[model samples]
Target: MSSYLLPAIAGLLTGAGLIVAIGPQNVFVLRQGVARRHTGAIVAVCAISDVVLIVAGVAGLGAIVAAHPQVITVAKLLGGLYVLVLGLLAAKRCLRSNEAIAANAEEAESAGRWVAVGTALALTWLNPHVYLDTVLTMGAIANGHGNGKWAFAIGACVASILWFTALGGGARRLSHLFASPRAWKILDAVVAVIMIGMAVALFASI
Candidate 1:
């Protein structure tokens, strides 16, 4: 039990560190939270996605990834381009004068539920960083725990669940702060910076 405890704690901390980074998936979740639109569904999707990835990582996908370097290269090229596009769109949103958080469910409902779900899936699955972090990095780390790898995976999975829940649920309370269009613009600007920075970093690493 003591052996498992340390790895579990390590997994939790490592998972939190990776997921806490501002990325496309997180920005989308924040937007949904602010809009108060299908927040639960989005949160669940993100958390579940992480869990699946993390489990795969722990199950030895990391070894396969390490053996084939070209996989990372291809993922980097495609993911970086995708992130770059998202950053540009975010920048455009910031420039628009009408950038405002929805104040009610009706306004938020303008976007179809399926659209939101599809976007969330794309943001989660399309990013190369997700593969790097979960399947490779986390997988390697979990395997380092030897017999306790499953325990570590559980800790990491729990972290993903908690973080998404907090991020999506907590944003609702801050809706009042984003009531102004200027606030939304500022948020978009910040998101644009994060996304573009990530894109550049992703490409640079390759």
Candidate 2:
């Protein structure tokens, strides 16, 4: 059997590095983890989406996308808008009933996997920066790894798995800690601030 150890590990680390930041995905993961709902779904979402995109990056699509000037411009605009919306939603979360968040989590419980995957795809494919990270950053990193480029990809994937697994698993323990409405409110408030700041920074780049 062909071994994907190096690629898997690289994939894992790369994915973790890119995703460990304070972003929407992290927010969603944190919220879901704190709630203890559909833990497996969340993990699958992060992992599967990573595999698909990493494959695309390694397949040369990353190179193609990097060459397009217009696409990059449009992507920056969209990323700014998306982050703004996410921030607004986060800010509004403080006002939302915990019941609503819990309910949405319930409704979302079934599709947690796809939700994660789709969310991953949207965030990556939709944001030109993802191309810069996965396709560009990861791709460049993959190059020097020699035959281990493939192994590096695998490592990146593994990193994602470890993080998400820790997310879902750790969430199980955090549920009780977030039992109060106040805690959720505070978290939402902070997440809103982060997202809004990122959104603002996006426009500054233009």
Candidate 3:
């Protein structure tokens, strides 16, 4: 159906473009992938969250969220703090494990299911931008494009699933490639930069 086609294509592009970037979600997925942790579950959480947000946006609730300045401000402060703290913690982990990571790979498996869920949820719900971007912007465009709101939401949701799945699996492969303390340092540094950048962008955006 042409109606669905539009949403699918839009969703694919949105998913591909955003996922390809080395953003927070990507970092989390990659961490799972490399550690060979509960990659599927983590990826699934992100995909599901995306679908929910996109649907809400398309259904018009996204507009309500964007309009509430206080909510956005609160999300910014909270999300920023969360990101900064997480980034610091990750950096600390990297430093602590720099020498033993490659040797004790088994011990370095991801924390737990709850940790992954909390990380992904904070990355999604805590940032008001997710609401604005996927729900508000994508929803508005999808809805404005005629009777293709669900279609677009579907597209984006599908895209998110595919991307997160791939990244989570792909990152694990890097254990062989970046098998050095320097590599962990670099990755941790990059994560720190991304987290800090996200915080700055979020706060400045307000």
Candidate 4:
């Protein structure tokens, strides 16, 4: 038990280091969380997706993914373009009048639930970094534990779940901070820059 416990701890720390970074998915989750809209669905999608990827990595799927450079190339292009569009949309929101911004917020609340869910899924699965981090990197680390690999995988999955849950849940506390149209605009501007920067980085990596 002690041996497994150590590996699990290692996995947890490793997973946290890879996941808690600012990225498109985190930005989307934070936005949805602040808006207090479909946060549960978004958190669930992101956490569950991480679990699937981590488990697949532990199960030796990482080797196959590592060998597939073309797959990463395709994902990089698609993900970069997708993030770029999202950034442009956010930037457009920043240009709206206060009244228009408020109206857009309302429209977002009324938007289809599936739309949010789909966006969450796309942001998670379409990014090449997800495969590299969870599949290749985490997979190799867990496998290093030999028979304790499953324990490591479990720890990593827990880390993913806890991080997203906290991110989504705690973000609502910032609702007071985002109460005004100006505040929302500011948030959108920040998100726009981050997303666009990420898209540029992704494209450059290819």
Instruction: Name the regions of candidate 4 deviating beyond 4 angstroms.
Output: none
Best by TM-score: 4
C-alpha positional error of residue 105 in candidate 2 after TM-score superposition, expressed in Å: 9.2
Q: Each model's C-alpha lDDT? A: 0.87, 0.71, 0.76, 0.94
Number of clashes in every candidate structure? 0, 24, 5, 0
Q: Which prediction has the highest lDDT against the true structure?
A: 4
Better of 3 and 4 by lDDT: 4
Q: Can you give the TM-score per candidate against the true fold?
A: 0.90, 0.79, 0.87, 0.98
Any idea what lDDT model 1 has?
A: 0.87
lDDT of 4 by residue, 56-107 (tens): 9999999998788889999999999999999999999999999887777777
Better of 1 and 3 by TM-score: 1
* Overall local distance difference test of candidate 2: 0.71
How much lDDT does candidate 3 score?
A: 0.76
For model 2, how does the per-residue alpha-carbon lDDT over 122-172 read when each residue is reduced to its tens digit? Answer: 654566566677777787777666677777777776676677788778877
Candidate 4, poorest ten consecutive residues by summed lDDT: 100-109
Query: Candidate 1 or 2, higher lDDT?
Result: 1
How should the candidates be ordered by lDDT, best one leading? 4, 1, 3, 2
